[model samples]
Target chain A: MSITISNISKSYKNVKALQDISFEVKENELFGLIGPDGAGKTTLFRILTTLLIANEGTATVAGFDVISDYKMIRNSVGYMPGKFSLYQDLTVEENLNFFATIFGTTIEENYDLIKDIYVQIEPFKDRRAGKLSGGMKQKLALCCALIHKPKVLFLDEPTTGVDPVSRKEFWDMLKRLQQKGITILVSTPYMDEAALCDRIALIQAGKILEIDTPKAIVKHYSKPIYNVRANNMYQLINSLNDYEYNHSVYPFGEFVHYTDKRADFNQKELKMYLETKNLTDIEIEKTIATIEDTFMELAK
Target chain B: MKIILYIIQKEFKQIFRNKGMLPIIFVLPLLQLVILSNAATFEVKNIKFGYIDNDHTSTSRTLVEKFNASTYFDVLTDFPSEGLASSSMLNGEVDVVLEIPQYFERDLQKEKYNSLGITINAIDGAAAGVENVYVTQIVQNFNQNLKVDLLQVSDKQIQPITIETIPLFWYNETLNYKTFMVPGILVLLVTMITLFLSGMNIVREKEIGTLEQINVTPIKKSQFIIGKLFPFWVIGIGLLTIGLIIAKLIFDVPMVGSLVLMYFYTSIYILVILGIGLFISNFTDTQQQAMFIAWFFTVIFILMSGLFTPIESMPEWAQILTEFNPIKYFVEVMRMVMLKGSSFIDVLPQIIKTFLFAFIMNGLAVWSYKKTT
Candidate 1:
């Protein structure tokens, strides 16, 4: 395993940020800690990176214990903090050179690794980091983190504030970095980004809900899901929940994806129930569960 | 060490690239050194005076002429009444008013006794004291003249007393206030700029979510800190060099001490400031908060550092409190080196104190910077 975390628990004053959290990322794998805000994603990342000591449990990155071998661990990892952490006053080229130098390396030595991304905005190398557009800054920060040629890259919500196109571009860059045989641990609140990961840990409220491949996790969802639509969608939802056969009913997009308590119940019964409530033009069909659906089910 | 140099290079780039703060950090200190140094002299000149001569006698007239003849006092008005002269003094229109009493010459001739009323505005006590001394000296000279004229015997003798202060002002012989003020103000500028920049740099990263990216990386805390502080240190030194050059050319402030010694002390001083800034940055989550806290401490340091006031004159407890202030030592060392031509041996104590402070503060800063898991 490239990374190992066992029974890692942490608390902040009165709030429990993580509880008995354990996970592992294999070498060169793109692992993700998926959760909403305040789900202890950041806490776990900090511990693995040796920035924070776990309250209870042990975590090791690349065969070195986070506590005892922190210096060695730090030397090998590339961390892009959740925030834009580069010096804003320094120009793009200067920031990159600084990070490279800190790692006891030079831009020319690692130019092949970052040249692809760095070249895109190389024209503005002299421009102050603070003045760059949001997308450009994101690319520059990534370049700086990668310039050190770290073995393990830990990115905490690298796409939180970026535009859609830039977000896509950033993820693509991460994939290329992963291709270089670097262990990648990335966390994000965006569920859509979760599917891009090779394996994901669904976390909520500082607890790991589940950990599995995206397809496998969705495949394991056991509920009889249905996407229900009707002319009066609101009334149809109320009528469906009020129905005696209802298990769970929640709005998902333009239609409501629901499940029934009776596994063998058909759509005719649901339609009859909706019609009895004076709801018309109702349509109901079975649908495949998504990661969000799995998350909602697990959260419940 | 390599990481530290990288950080230093980055810091220099940032300081120079920042258009808004470049002028403030570099130019403003030099401008103040020039303007305020000229304005801050203790030598008094151009005193305005008014007089009420009730005696209307030759001796009183002659004394009035003597006052006019001296360049120190510009005799603006000759009032007929004491009421008018006193009102002018109360209104601050005149700094000093000489009131001559009735039959001043006759009394001097018969009884060898006379009195003169001298009213002075005493708001600025130091200047007022000096003016009083000058007035007393002139009166004594006038009395001697009277004695000389009345008792023409060559054998006549008079007692004389003189007080002299052989002021051996070490460091700055001429006592140019700029020589003192430039180095002191430079300390403030360096401290303020570095503290604010370093304090704000980390917080800004935290706000923008990039700190997390670095955190996940295998980079060590020491590496990160060295990377961050190195740049700010370079910028601080660069600003000091510019300030020194300006002080030399525009103000003619002497660089009496060894340049190498100055650089050595300044390097340690920058570390102390950068450490303080990083420590503050680690605690604050926002740039605004970091800036406010940095500004607060800097204001206190500059005010209590004895840049504008004598540390010796402050109450004993206040003077004791200043011992803990790092800026005080930096300012002291800079002035000692620049003005007094002090060698490294003379400034060894301050240098050692700064080195210890830099170590403690930087250690605390790195200790405090943790990944908030």
Candidate 2:
């Protein structure tokens, strides 16, 4: 295992950030922690990176104990915090060089590791980090984190504020880095990104709801979800929620995903109930379950 | 070693890249040195003078004329009655009021002794005291001349002997306020700028979230701290150099001692300031908090530094408090070295104390500074 966390718990004052959070990431694996905001993803990242001490339990990264061998762990991991943390005054090239030097390595020594990402923002090498667009800054931050070529990389919400195209490119680069034998533990609030990981842990309110491969997690939901749409999304949702057999009702993009309480659920009954209410053009069809559906089911 | 150098290089790059802060670091202190040294003075001048001549004699007119001739007094008004003079004083038109008694010079010749009534505005006690000394000197000079004129008329054969004490101001012969103040103000500029800059630098990293990123790196604490502080140390010395040049060329403040000794002392003195700055940064989470705390201590340090007031005259307890003040020692050392030409051994005790301060403050700062929490 490249990372091992056992019963790690952390609290800030009265709020529990993490409780009995135990998990593992195999070597060369790209693991994702998928959750919404304030879900203890950052706290877990900080603890594993040795920037914070857990209130209980223990963890290790890159085969070194987080507490007893924190120094060794620090030397072996690359952490990109959720916030943009590079020096804004320094040029992109300077920021990259600075991180490389502090890690006891040089850019030329690890050019092969960061070439794909660095080349994307190489034209803006002279521009200060503060002046770059959001996408470029994210790329530069990734380049800086990878310049030292550590054994594991921890990215906290790297795609939170990025555009769609850059977010896709960022994940593709992560795939390439994983092929180079680097273990990666990343967190994101966007559930769609979970499918790109080898495995994911679904978390909410400091508790892990489920952990498994994204496909397996979604398959384990074992409920037939129906996509229901009408002229009025609000009225459709309200009518479905008022149905007697309704188990769950969530708006997913253009359609309302609904699950029934009974094992032998009747779709005609739900459609008839929405028709009586004032909603028009109602359509109901069985839809495949997704990671988001599984997360919603487990969280509920 | 290499990592520390890289960190230092990065720090210098960031410091120089800040366009708004460059002038604050370099130009403002020199400007303050020139403006404050010339403006902040102790010698009180241009005191408004008003008097009532109840004596109505040539002797009283001569006394008033003496005050008019002196540069220290403006001799603004001549009141007909004591009440008018009192009202003028009340209205703040005059600072010193002299009332000659109704004796017309006859009492002086007959009794061989007389006293004049001198009223001074004591609102500013120190300035009032200086004004009083000036008034007495003029009156005493007039008395000396009067004795000569009277003795010639009455008895020319006998000569009276009087005791005289002539004070020779040793280091500052002319008592130029600028010469005395330039070094102290230079100390203030150096201490204030270095303390504020060093204190806010680390907290700026914290505010921007870069500190969290750096904390995860394998960089040692000493390497990070020394690298962060080294640039400000150089800037502090750079300020002292600029201030000294200004002191030499503009103010003509003498550099009586060796320049090497001043630099050596300042080099060590800056360490104490940087340590204090780092300590402040260690405790604060924001630049604003660090700045407020730095300003708080800088004000206290500047006031108690004996820069403006003499520490010897403070209450015993306050005097003891100043013993712990680092600026007090810097002020004393700068004044002693620049004005009095004091040698190394003369400032050895200060050197020892400052060295200890640097050690303790930096130790506490580094110890309190945590990379992991």
Candidate 3:
């Protein structure tokens, strides 16, 4: 295993940030911690990177105990926090060179590892990190984190504020990094990004609700879902919630993803009920459960 | 060692690149050195003088003429009565009032003793005290001359024995306040700049979240701290050099001690300040908080540093408190070496104390700094 966490719990004052969170990521696997804001994803990452100590339980990164062998873990792992944590006053090249030098290596030593990402921002090598755009800043942060070419990478919501196009490009970079045999433990609030991981843990309020392959996790939903659209998205959601047989109703991008309480739910019945409520242009069709539907169901 | 060097290089880069900070580090302190040494003075002058001649005799007129001849007193007005003198003092027209009593010359001739009434405004006690000294010296000179004149008329052969003491002021012979103050103010500039800058440096990283990134690295605590503080240490020395140059060129303050010794002492002294700064940065989270705390300590240290006030005049308890003040030792060392031409052995006690302070403060700073919490 590249990482192992068992019964890890942490609390700050009265609020418990993480509670009995336990999971593992195999070597070369791309693992994701899927949750909303304040879902203990950052707390978990801090614990694994040895930036914070868990109040209870134990975690090991790269076969080194996070507490006893923290030095080894620090030496072998790379971390990019959610916040942009580079020297803003330093130029892009300086920031990269600094991180590399402090890690007892040089950019030339691992040029092959970061060459693909570095080339993108090479034009702005002399520009200070603070002057870079949002996407460019994230790219530089990722490059700094990967300069050491470590065995594991901990990226905490690296795409939270990035544009969609740059976000896709960032994910592509991560895919290539994984191909180079680096185990990645990433967290994201975006559920669509969760499917790109080899395995994911659906987390909410400091607790892990489910952990499995994205395909398997969605299969675990065990309920039929319908993509129901109408002229009025608000009334369609309201009508679905008002129906007695409706198990759940959520607005998911131009449609209401709904589940019926009964195992044998009738689509025509749901449409007839919506029409009665004066909700026109109602279109209901059976759709496969996505990772988002699974997460929402598990979160509920 | 190489890591520390790299961190130092980065720090220098950031410091030079900051447009708003370069003047603060270099220009402001030098300006303060020039302005403060010239402005903060101890010698009081331009005392307004007034007198009432109750006896219209030559003796009283001669006494009044003595005060008029002195450079310190302005001799502004001659009041006709004690009431007028009191009113003039109350109106803030005069600082000193001398009332020669009635029959002043007759009493001195018949009884050989007479008292004169002298009043002084006591607001700004230090200046008033200086004014009183000037007044007494002038009156005593007049009395001495009167005694000589009377002795020659009364008995020519009898000569009274008198003791005269000629005091020589060493090092600062002219009692130049600027010469005394220049080196002390230089200490303030060096201490304040290094403390404020180093205090805010690490906390800035914390505020910007780079501290968390660095914490996850494998860098040792000692290496990071040494690297972080070394740049400010250099700035402190650089400031001392610039301040010394200003002290020599602008103020004409003496540098009697070896230049090498001053640099050697300042190099260690800056470590003590940098250590305190690092300790403060370890506890604070924001640059503003660090600056506030740094400013608080700086104000206290500057006042208690004996730069403006003599340490001997401070209360016993406050004097004891100043022993722990690092600026006190620095001010003392600067004056001793720069003015007194003291040797290494002369300043060894201060060197030992400052080195111990550096060791303890840096130790506490390193111990409190945690890579994980």
Candidate 4:
């Protein structure tokens, strides 16, 4: 395992940011910490990356203890923080050179490591980081982080606030890095990105609810799930929430992914119930579970 | 060391690239040095004088002429009545008012002694006290002149044992206030520039999110602190050099000692100031908070550093409080070396105190900073 976090807990005064979070990320694995905002994803990432100290338990990254061997971990890992943390006043080329040099290497020595990502921004080499668009800034930050050719990489919400197309391109870059034998640990609030990871952990409220491959995590959900929709979406939602045995009701895209606690639950009965509420054009169908369905099931 | 050099290189590049900050760092200190040096002075001049001379005797007239003759007093007017002189004093037209009673000259002739009623504006207590001294000195000179003019072999002529003493002001002859203030003000400018820059620089990085990147790196805390402070240290030294040049060319202020020694003291002193600033930076989250804290300490340090007031003249407790101020030692060293031509031994005590201060403060800076909390 490249990262082994055992019973890690942290609190900020009165708020318990992370509590007894335990997980392991294997070598060269693109592991994803999947959760919504404030779900302890960042707290875990910060602890494992050696930027924070966990109050209870231990974390080892690259076989180095987070506290005792922080220097070793710092040297072996690259972190692109949740925010764009590169010097905003520096030009693109200057920023890249500065980070590379500080890590005791030159840009020429690590040209190949950052080439694919740097080429897109090579044209704006003289542009100050602050002036770049959100996507461009993300690309530059990644290049700076990777310039050292780290053994493991930690990306904290790298795709937040990025355009979808640019977000796809960033994931592609991470995949290429993994092919180079670099273990990647990335966190994101977007559920669909979970499928891009080798294994995923569903996390919420300072605890991990499930950890498994995206496909397996979905299969791990034992409940029968349904997609319910109607011409009056809002009224339909209220009617279904008022259903006698509905387990969970959350909107997914144009439909609501729902489950019911009734063992003999019938979709025919649900549709009949919505019709009496003056809802028309109803669509109900059994759907295969995805990571989103699995996460909602476990989080609740 | 290489990592530190890279950090320093990056810092210099950022500093030079900031167009708005270049003039502020390079030109503003020298400007303040020249303009403020003229304004900050202890030498009291231009004391406005008005007196009521009811007797109108030669002695009283001589007293007024004596006041007019002294460069310290302007001798604005002679009021016929005490009421008129009091009115002038209330209007703020005169700083000192001398009231000679109707029998003033007769009293001196009969009683062999006379007292002059002198009222002074004490709003600026220091200036008022200094003006009183100047008036007493002129009156004493007139008393001697009276003895000679009277040609008295009387009982008063027994000749009180008088010791004639000549005061000689060395180093800064003519006692030009600028000569004394330029070096002190230069120290303040150097201090303010380095402190504000170092204090704000790290906090700004924290705000912009770059400090997190630096923190997660494998760089040592001491190395990072050194790298962060090196640029401002150079800037502080650069300011001192420029200020010294201006003091030489414009103000004709003397630098009788070794320039190399001054630079050496400043190099160590800059570390103390930069260390304090970085400590403030590490504690604060935003540049505004950092600035407020830096300004608070800067104002306190400057006021108590003996820049405007003499440390020796302050109350015993206040003087002891100044002992902890690095600026106080620096001001003393700058003047001792620049004006007095003091060699290494002459300034050894100040240098040692500053060295210890720099050591303690920078140690505190490094100890207080934490990459992982």
Best candidate, TM-score:
2
Q: Candidate 4 — which residues are off by over 4 angstroms?
A: A266-268, A275-281, B56-62, B77-88, B103-114, B142-163, B370-373
Weakest 10 consecutive residues of candidate 2 chain B by summed lDDT: B151-160
iRMSD in angstroms, per model: 3.5, 0.9, 0.8, 1.3
The order of the candidates by TM-score, greatest first, is: 2, 3, 4, 1
- Residue-by-residue lDDT tens digits, candidate 3, A1-300: 999999999999999999998888999999999999999999999999998889999999999999999999999999999999899999999999999999999999999999999999999999999999999999999999989989999999999989999999999999999999999999999999999999999999999999999999989978888899999887787778889998999898888898889987888888888889998888888888999898888888
Model 3 spans > 4 angstroms off: A228-245, A262-285, B50-62, B78-93, B99-114, B148-152, B155-161, B371-373
Candidate 1 regions with alpha-carbon error over 4 angstroms: A89-95, A106-140, A147-151, A162-180, A230-246, A262-281, B1-3, B78-91, B149-307, B321-373
Reference contacts preserved by each model: 0.67, 0.91, 0.85, 0.83
Per-chain TM-score, chain A, candidate 2? 0.98
Error of 1 at A222 (Å): 3.1
Per-residue lDDT of A26-110 in model 4, one digit per residue for the tens? Answer: 9999999999999988888888877778899998999999999999988989999999888888999999988887788889998
Q: How many angstroms is residue A165 displaced in model 2 relative to the true structure, after the best TM-score fit?
A: 1.4
Q: Which 10-residue span in candidate 3 chain A carries the lowest summed lDDT?
A: A233-242
Output per-candidate TM-scores for chain A, rounded to 2 decimals: 0.93, 0.98, 0.98, 0.97
- lDDT, each prediction: 0.84, 0.93, 0.92, 0.89
Q: Could you give candidate 1's per-residue lDDT for residues B154-270 as a string of tens digits?
A: 635553455656788766677677778888877877788888888898887787665755565444677777777777777788888887887888888888778889898999999
Model 4: per-residue Cα lDDT at residue A298: 78
Winner on TM-score between 1 and 4 is 4
